[model samples]
Target: MAKRNRKKNQAGFVFPAPLAVVLVVLAGFSLVYVCLKAKTEALGQEIKALESRSVQLRQDVVREQCEWASRLSPASMEQALKAHGLVMTWPGREQIVRMRADGTIDSSVIPEVRPPARYARVDRVVMND
Candidate 1:
């Protein structure tokens, strides 16, 4: 009777320690996995935010380029030139007045021109003596 009881007790207790060890190892692994999962999720969110910002920056660049293109169009340039009294005459099509040896255009057909004087006005103050 004692031998049978001893054998039964040994067999039943054989798996407890190994099962407890396995449970502990599994718990530790689960904790590590949860931490890693959380970190990976955070990194994914950051990547998504950066991608959205990059797209927005690209769109802004395209919009600015379009605006600049419109502003620098040939018609706009011609209008600006007209406002300044400048004409885009093709090469060899302009009326070239020949310059004389005195560094002046030939006065036979062209009149001599002079620049206007520039002046600034100052207000005078009257003081009582």
Candidate 2:
């Protein structure tokens, strides 16, 4: 038995192992960079959308406050009462007694503003002669 002489291989020069590894690593880094860039852009869009939503919510709050204030106006309250068929007559000039600077309607009447229950209660005494 005898081994036959093979012809010289004609394959082109192959890249060295370390160069191939470096190229693969560079490609991987480029791919990671592209993925990170895309993620950042997506986050930016989300932030923009949230900011617009917050602005809309603030505007809605302001609109609601304005509506509440208008509804609470004296004219609006009177209009609502009239719509409900309720007639309230103002007091006659003779019936309306002006309060004194000392918060007394008369010797027997003393007006007081009470604090909420969470505070300590204090009894007020007014001496009348």
Candidate 3:
């Protein structure tokens, strides 16, 4: 083929090397930023999950407390004790004696805070003279 009307091919655009390098660096920085953002979002989700678990545990504790209160109600405890043939009564003034306060435990008749084995097992110990 004969080259006809070939004046010049100087119509192409030339990109600057330093500007291209800067654009490449900017692209690298953008990639690093995107990675960090993704990691941050994942951590946020984990935090939300932990918070939900904490809330659920707190709710469970509250429910347990309400159940415990219901079980420990006066009516229920009295009924249970009566059904078990347990009689719990306060001690008379004569049954309680004061200590000498001389670093000695005064006890002529020790009061029983715990019910009999047939009833509930109380955690309190009553010391009286």
Candidate 4:
């Protein structure tokens, strides 16, 4: 009877060792899962902040472009040109003169202006090659 009782106690001890090993594995896995969750949340917050900053920069660019356009109207451009002693002149007609390589000259008539200017009835000349 003493021998049988000793064997039964040894069997119970063997079962608890495996159960302890399983608990240790489960604890390690739980720690890893928690770490990954925290890292993912931090990365998501960073992405949101960067996106908000990008949107604000885009809005600032659009506002600056509109302000510049409002200040640089046609009248302002004309005034600035005149301040530099530069005047816009329109050509009425054109006469093309071509010179040959052998010192010969050939002349032809070309209509350089079609429609007149907006405010002034002067003809604008456009040269094309």
Q: Identify the candidate with maximal TM-score.
A: 2
Model 3: how far residue 116 lies from native, Å? 17
lDDT of 3: 0.83
By TM-score, the candidates rank as 2, 3, 1, 4
Q: Residue by residue across 1-129, what tens digits does model 2's lDDT show?
A: 766545444465767999999999999999999999999999999999999999999999999999999999999999999998776777544445668899767744433444533424568878794
Write down the RMSD of candidate 1 (Cα, Å): 8.8
Best-matching candidate per lDDT: 3
Q: Would you estimate the TM-scores of all the predictions?
A: 0.50, 0.60, 0.51, 0.48
Per-residue alpha-carbon lDDT of candidate 3 for residues 4-26, written as tens digits (9 for 90 to 100): 56457565577988999999999
Q: What is the lDDT of residue 57 in candidate 3?
A: 98
Residues 1-129 of candidate 1 have per-residue lDDT tens digits of 445666556546355788899999999999999999999999999999999999999999999999899879999889989998777765341334679898987757553444642344568988895
C-alpha displacement of 43 in model 3, angstroms?
1.9
Cα error of candidate 1 at position 55, Å: 1.9
lDDT of each: 0.80, 0.81, 0.83, 0.75
What would the C-alpha RMSD of candidate 3 be, to one decimal place? 11.7
Give the range where candidate 2 is weakest over 10 consecutive residues by summed lDDT: 110-119
Q: What is the lDDT of residue 91 in candidate 4?
A: 52
